[model samples]
Target: MSTPELHWFKSSFSSSSEPGDCVEVARTPAMIHVRDSKTPGTSHVTVASATWESFLAYVTE
Candidate 1:
């Protein structure tokens, strides 16, 4: 699917001082889509929702 078709949003933890430097994410029922805010639509990584949750838990800890 195209990036535009997805509703992308910047992470709340993203640095507001540098507007261009951030991570954007989109979501589906079973997948989490991630991409660089600077290079939208060019490439992205898709991961299972469970995996994304795990990653978040790891990092937040």
Candidate 2:
């Protein structure tokens, strides 16, 4: 599949004032995109909006 037009933002959970390993997050109308900041263009994962929310809720619980 073609890559979606996603504008990724670094997660608020990240606390690195320096450049190193990090995770990025982006959201579309229907889904969320997640990727590594160091390897922005090549490594990533995606999930449906509902699934992403569920995952976050679980993590924060």
Candidate 2 vs. true structure, TM-score:
0.79
Residue range 11-55, candidate 2, lDDT tens digits: 976768766767899999888889888888696787999999998
lDDT for position 44 in model 1 = 94
Model 1: per-residue Cα lDDT over 1-61, one tens digit each: 6644688899776889987999999998889999999999698999999999999999889
Steric overlap count per candidate: 0, 0
Which residue ranges in model 2 land beyond 4 Å of their true spot? Answer: 1-4
Top model by TM-score, which number? 1
Q: In candidate 1, what residue range of length 10 has the lowest lDDT sum?
A: 1-10
Query: What stretches of model 1 exceed 4 Å from their correct place?
Result: 1-4
Best lDDT among the predictions, by candidate number: 1
